[model samples]
Target: MRILEVEHLSAWYPSGRTRRQVLEDVSFTLDRGQVLGLVGESGCGKTTLARAILGLHRACAGVVRHAFPRPQMVFQDPYGSLNPAHTLLWTLEEPLRAIGTGRKERRDRAMELLDRVGLGPEYAGRYPQELSGGQRQRAAIAAAVIARPALVVADEPVSALDVTVQRQILDLLAELKRDDSLSYLFISHDLNVVYQICDRILVMDKGRIVEENDTDTLFAAPKHPFTKKLLEAAE
Candidate 1:
């Protein structure tokens, strides 16, 4: 099933006194269990496109249709994404709590997610400031998938982590995708990183998706100059 469908989406941001377009007529569909990568350089509207889909950025025009409930986002900076003052338990439980879930159920769900992301229940009481970068990203992932969201918009999820930690986080995301049938709109500038988790890829340049193809095909034979350049840079 198609979990997400974006059509004719165009978004802009304030620049000087005028608005500058960030995404232009961007359209794509993400299947229920597919990991769709959005790849491009910085300032290429990747994040803006994500925000458009989530209805977070309003200075835009387009249609973002999705069936996923409470779509989640795992931002690039895990440290900033999470609240420093809140305990991990509180962070994990926030989603369930928002839905009026019973207290016991929320706690159970939170603990289960903590373990699922490879962060043991022991870390639940700790504040975000107390966890390592990798630990914090794990917690961020846990919170993102805590409610079993059908579509997760992960924007540069592992860009700030070390190589080993990036690999671990990628593995964890892959495992979660398998376990929950999760669909990810994975965004990043690093083609190598996107290659790890994305089943398909969309190449964006200058507020437009210049090319779209399956991961294997895109990597093996990129048609667009921009896409080819991106692959070359990653090499």
Candidate 2:
């Protein structure tokens, strides 16, 4: 079933006096429990589209309709996204607390999520500064899902990590999707990683969707020149 429908969406940024288009008439649907990969180079408007969908961006027009719980984001840099003063437990519990989850339940859920994300009990009291990059990212992932969101917008979630850590985080995300029946708007320039996790792929070029297809078909025979270049670079 369709969980989201983004129709004729567009966004523009102020450019000196006039406006410059960043996203141009983009339209797509995300079904329930689907992982949709959005791949593009820098300045391709992938991020702008994601922000618009999350209601975090202005200067946009058109419709963004969804039939699901509120969406959350897992940012590229946990160091910057997470509050340094807050412990990982506090960070994870904040979401639950926002909707009137009791203190005891918040604590219990936080600890459970910490364990679920492969972080031990000892890590709970530690601040974001104390954890490694991978650990922080894991905590971030836990926080994003703590409120039982049906959809998540993960923008370059593993780009800053080591190769090994990237694989681990991807596997964690895959498992979470399976367990939670979650959908993802996974934004990244990394084609190989997208190929590994995404069921379908949308390729962006010059602020528009240049190509889209199922994972295997998109990789086997890319129709767009820009998509071909992306695959070649990934190889």
Candidate 3:
């Protein structure tokens, strides 16, 4: 089933003299249990497209439709994304609280989420500073999935971690996808990582999708010049 559909979406930021387009007529669809990788250079609007889909950024035109509960975001910097003052438990519980879950149930759910993300319940009592980068990211992932969102917008979620830790986090994400049948809009510059996790891929350039194909096909025989460059760099 189609979980997300973005049609002709466009977004812009105000420049000194006029508006600078950051996303132009971008469109895509994400199916249930499918992982769609968005790959591009730093200024290519990958994150902008994610924000537009999540309503964090204003879209100048087009439509975004989702057939699931409110989509959640997992940002690159786990430390920055979470509230420093809040315990991990509080971070996980806040979503339930917002939705009117009972106090006891909130605590129970928080612990459950922690376990699902590969963190123990005891870690929930600690603050963000107490956890390693990977652990903090696990907390962030736990919080993001606490409400069981239909689609997750993960923007460079593991980019900050060491190689070993990055693999662990990627494994956790893959496990979650299987256990929950989750759909993901994974944004990353690393084609290797994207290839490992994503079933399909979209290549962006200057705010537009320049190439898109299934992972195997795209990796074996990339069609776009930009895609060829990315593959060459990954070698």
**Looking at model 1, how many pairs of residues clash?**
0
lDDT of each: 0.92, 0.92, 0.92
In candidate 3, which residue pairs get closer than 3 Å at backbone N, Cα or C atoms, i.e. clash?
A: none
Where is model 1 more than 4 Å wrong at Cα? Answer: none
- Cand. 1 Cα-lDDT: 0.92
TM-score of each: 0.98, 0.98, 0.97
User: What's model 2's overall lDDT?
Assistant: 0.92
In model 3, the Cα lDDT at residue 90 comes to 94
lDDT of 3 by residue, 24-138 (tens): 8988899999999999999899888989898888747799999986899999987798889999999999988888899999999898878888888889889998889999999
Q: Report the poorest 10 consecutive residues by lDDT, candidate 3.
A: 52-61
Candidate 2 residues lying further than 4 Å off, grouped into runs, are none
Across residues 1-235, which tens digit of lDDT does each residue of candidate 2 receive? 8988999999999999999999999999999899999999988998899999999999999999978767999999878888988888889999998888999999998998899889988999999988889999999999999999989999999999999999999999999999999999999989988988999999999789989899999999999998989999999
lDDT of 1 by residue, 1-235 (tens): 9999999999999999999989889999999999999999998999989888998899999888988678989999988988988999999999888888899999998998898889888999999999899999999999888877899999999999999999999999999999899999999999999888899999999999999999999999999999988888888
For candidate 2, the 10 contiguous residues with the lowest summed lDDT are 65-74
Ten consecutive residues with minimal summed lDDT in candidate 1? 61-70
Ranking by lDDT: 1, 2, 3
- Quote the lDDT for 128 in model 3: 94
Candidate 3 residue spans exceeding 4 A from truth: none
Q: Estimate candidate 1's RMSD in Å.
A: 0.9
